[model samples]
Target: MALTVHSRFHPIHTDLAVVTLTGDVDISTAARLRDDLAALLGDGARHLVLDLGDVSFMDSSGLSVLAGVFPLLRESGALALAAVNPRIREVLRTTGLTRLFPIYTSVDTAITVLRAGDDAPS
Candidate 1:
């Protein structure tokens, strides 16, 4: 199945883009996913939350796509994952990537927590 990627800003935090992915993310779809994700950051997303509840499978290419964005994001912002399944979680664990990202149980929770950090008095 083709990967379906969609992005929307949080209602309370316009700079945070909540990107939702459905279907498989493999070699065939990794490039397209990369472009879509880059577009989100380029369009001024200071923070990103990826909702992966509906994405059933992901391969190394997909992991590569996600890993590729980390540096650019750290220079200006952050990235989080939501609703990751066991299979993908294992992939991340095995690759030692789980330490690099904060995974939440839901998109809403991720938004709330990330937003709270920004809202803190500096």
Candidate 2:
């Protein structure tokens, strides 16, 4: 089955952008995610919260896109992942990426942290 990724962007506060993702993020959909995120950053988004609650899967390609964007986001802003499923969380943990990205239980919590300027890696 072909997996389709869907992204929805919402502006929170003044500088935070929330991108909600649904469906699997594999080779076929990683590019779309990257483009969507790049567009948000291009639009002057200084803080980003990726709500991955509906994302059922994410492959190495997806992880690559995220890893590549981390430094870019940090150069002028912050990025956080919210509601990541257990499978995806394990991937991050196993790859030691858990240290690079802040993971939250919900979008609201992520937004709150970013808004408070406490998004620095812990």
When summed lDDT is taken over every stretch of 10 residues in candidate 2, the lowest stretch is 1-10
Q: Which candidate tops TM-score?
A: 1
TM-score quality measure for candidate 1: 0.95
CA deviation > 4 Å runs, candidate 2: 1-12, 118-122
* lDDT by residue for model 1 (18-76), tens: 99999999999999999999998888899999999999999999999889988878866
Candidate 2 lDDT, 56-105, residue by residue in tens: 98899999988988999777678899999998999999998899899999
Model 2: how far residue 71 lies from native, Å: 1.0
TM-score of every model?
0.95, 0.87
Q: Give the TM-score of candidate 2.
A: 0.87
C-alpha RMSD by candidate, in order: 1.1, 3.1
Clashes of each: 0, 0
Best by lDDT: 1
lDDT of 2: 0.82
lDDT on C-alpha atoms for all candidate structures: 0.91, 0.82
